[model samples]
Target: MEVSVNQDNFSILECFSSPTRIRIIELLNERPMNIRSLSEALDIKPPIVTRHIQMLEQAGIVASELIAGKRGQQKLCSLKLEQMVLNFRSQIHNKKPSVQKYDVMIPVGMYADYEVKPSCGLASEHSMLGMCDDPRYFADPVHRDARVVWFSSGFIEYRIPNYMLYNEQASSLEVSLEICSETPCSSSHLQPSDIVFSFNGIDVAVWTFPGKIGKGTAIFTPQWWHKDIQHGVMKHIRVNEQGTFIDGVLVSNMTIDALSLCADEEIVMRISSRSDAKRCGGVTLFGSGFGNYNQDIHCTITCK
Candidate 1:
């Protein structure tokens, strides 16, 4: 899992603040070692080494397991993070003059309309909402608490409130959500699938998720979540005067003006799999209580 360095991660950062822990990470990078070996190599007391390991393990920087050894059961330690990047820019928030912004988060199961095929299912954090592949479950009242929703085909549509844009000109619009290609179970196959995003009947962008994602556990996924089924990635799709962007990188020439959005018009956001896609891996939407990023379908409109 990737995490940005910020105030929220101060505890994690503190784990790296110690020289002894830093050396331990370097030693573990070479190979997994027991507490005795680490103590000997670092020339530190065994108790001191154990204390450092506990802190590292709590911060998810290192992992330890007990195994039979020549003397007795020994704890094996290994590094979890292969790389770390520190960026100061993420902490800075820029404010613009005369800009009014409205933000809304749509829960995964609260779609205005939907049509799904087999292999579809919905689950809350605690348990499955209903029988898998049963389309009727989409309309179930209990779906409102759904944390994850997956389907083999079809689309899900949402109606975003546009009253905030009334009498104001929208300078830009952004829709961010966590999504991934769907499969029977987590597979390693990197099949190409075209996922389209449309706004107000205009095709804004068609992103191709490389494959079904599920090698490891998501950072925020609940403990009860099945290990075999993993969380999707967080993606940001933006439309502005400059053009359309996915995760801050331009992917299309479509601009906000082309949408022809009206001040009082309700915005229609639709996500669908292209019928002509070479591979139909399906789609999964993650909500606030699920996935690596604990967020729902977030929509932000910046007006001037």
Candidate 2:
């Protein structure tokens, strides 16, 4: 597909300009509402709502569906933020972020740990034993890598190189990865996770997954996945120095923290899934299905 916004051109800038359109996005973010609902929510007439909806829809910012309402068919409206880039300044381009490195000599797997539940059950290429058998296995205090299916309510700790301590101009550190969980399957109900990244056991940031991540993968099929419910239900969380991004859009400003690591201590990112079966059906970790940080679900640290 067409990836990366070329420049801060008209088509891109227009995506965020209109006041009515912005209100429409804000209203839809809460829950999908039809014409009457949106009209009441935004204090606009039905004709005005329809006009703005059409404009937003044309820009691919909003979409509508005809669903059964209390009376007749209702055009349920919602936002479709598949992915977008907002450039407040023209200095940056709609391309991948730049990466630079300071020379260092260290072991490859020096600061990484992974665990899976049910012994080697998650090692299978295609199975669900690790995630479905028991929800507690996710917090089993051991096991890491998985293949078919796995769940964990604990953090996957990765100690980053303590290069930031000595580096004079290390502006920021960026950690990006593809992650999804079983707890909250659908993006529609996308809720934040309790996953925390810690520096020397000090909590740095609490992260959550974005909506509609693994939409086409079979891994999203729950034990009781029904045709009535949306299949390929999944969510993703990708954060960097700029902001926290879910799916492909920016959601929050809780970016990765730059820490001093010259003491030779490990910088860790721990992902914890709260034990809420009602929220996440439990936590199913999708390793390879997501991008896995543009490489493996591993850690990367660069210091200037």
Candidate 3:
């Protein structure tokens, strides 16, 4: 589930190295079970099962919760992931690039400015931030931990450091995020929306995303996240001397120079669904640890 396992993390590696733990994962994949059930199924002692479960939980491979049972409350264990990806890039040597670069990942809920309408709300992996269609919740302190946000109209803005662009001939500025078209909370059918993106108030590009994105489970989506909408596709938007592009295809003539980025200046990224657009189905932004792409607002500047 977009797991980035660094080779240096011996503790996590050791957790997976155990055959008993591996068997535990396989058992949980079938279905969530309690300590007693797991012990019986795996023929392990209760204490050993508890110990392995604790280790798996610490390694983020499993999650447990207490639930009402006939005997009282029982701890239920489940697999937290369907797959794991090992990243070995840091272990390999590569040639350095010629350009200087800087990057930052801003969380989805950390909006510098926002104006949203009803049908707007946020949620964490475990629970909804507040009541759906309640605007006041958007301003709640808990929003800082939101993993996803959606609105029928208006904009959400983020300010990123632009010092890397100051006085330097920037080769390219890239902004990448996971997004999808929004719909009525109860609707499961497809809707279309024209989502606009801007940098420093300069319109960059408008992308049309087809709705009904949650047809299947997202690789990283938590089991508890049962909603009509669940995930979004990763989209890459770039601005350079040539033009603005969405996923590598030029979509507009708006160049990076038009943004007038300066040293120590903060680049404002605004995402909105204008009222005059052909479609205003809505827009949803997925944050780190929530969507198929385990990333937030990724911004990078390459300077020559």
Candidate 4:
């Protein structure tokens, strides 16, 4: 999870203020456990442990669900974030160069082009778009309303409306979205898929998603939605003169210059998994209504 180091992320930052909360995270990291188990291990009361878990949940750092325990039912808690980066740059991006920039929220369903196969389907906040595991449903007229989309193979493309003027040259581009491996609803199935990101049809970044279907519900996921794929890791794909980065880690040497974007040219971003990829597991895209983040595919462009 990437959080800007500012007042906007005060809740996330405050998560580290309490020793009890820190210890709780350390314990959950070992394995998923119930609040009763946590209370016993930490020598704390179950009520206090539940309160701590609630604070962590508010920060999107922990996930919990009600399940049948040996006695009856209990709230099972688990660590949700594998890594967290407090980015200081995001809050100060307008320091130098041109301030001419724009941000857009492109819904996951608003794909301009796509080529997908079975084990695929999409749904909005209220209901499924069409039939599950059917490629034909992807073309249904109402698909534009999809907030959660998944496919076992192939690619999906979206048009990022370029807002730069003819005299403007892009200095950097950043896109953030929630994604995970596509797999049938099974907590045991942790599918790892190599997902490739391209701009204007040119491959720029590639990363392997260590996917797992969580049993707990996402922060923004509606109650009607199934726990098939609870939530996905939020990823930040950035392109600059230096190189391409995924979550601040350089994934490719390919620089932003490779895109060669021009005026009146809408950038085409393609997310694909090669058929021969060693880990051709699949992909799932989460949007405003179905993931931890209550936002769509966010694109930001800064130009000079």
The numbered model that scores best in TM-score is 4
Compared with the true structure, what per-residue lDDT tens digits does model 4 show for residues 168-249? Answer: 9987788989888864332336588999999988899888997655446676678898656767877889898889988778
Model 3 poorest ten-residue lDDT run: 1-10
TM-scores of all predicted structures: 0.67, 0.41, 0.67, 0.70
Q: For model 3, how big is the CA root-mean-square deviation?
A: 9.0
What tens digits encode model 2's per-residue C-alpha lDDT throughout 21-92?
A: 788888876545789988998788999899888877777777787756678888767665545555454444
Instruction: Give a tens-digit lDDT track for model 1, residues 196-257.
Output: 89999898888988874644766456777764556676678889998998876789999999
lDDT of 1: 0.79
> Which regions of candidate 3 fall more than 4 Å away from where they truly are?
1-98, 183-186
Per-residue error for 5 in candidate 2, Å, reads 12
TM-score of 2: 0.41
lDDT of 4 at 195: 93
- How many residue pairs clash in each candidate at the backbone level? 0, 16, 0, 0
lDDT of each: 0.79, 0.47, 0.80, 0.83
Task: Give me the displacement of residue 204 in model 1, in angstroms.
Answer: 0.7
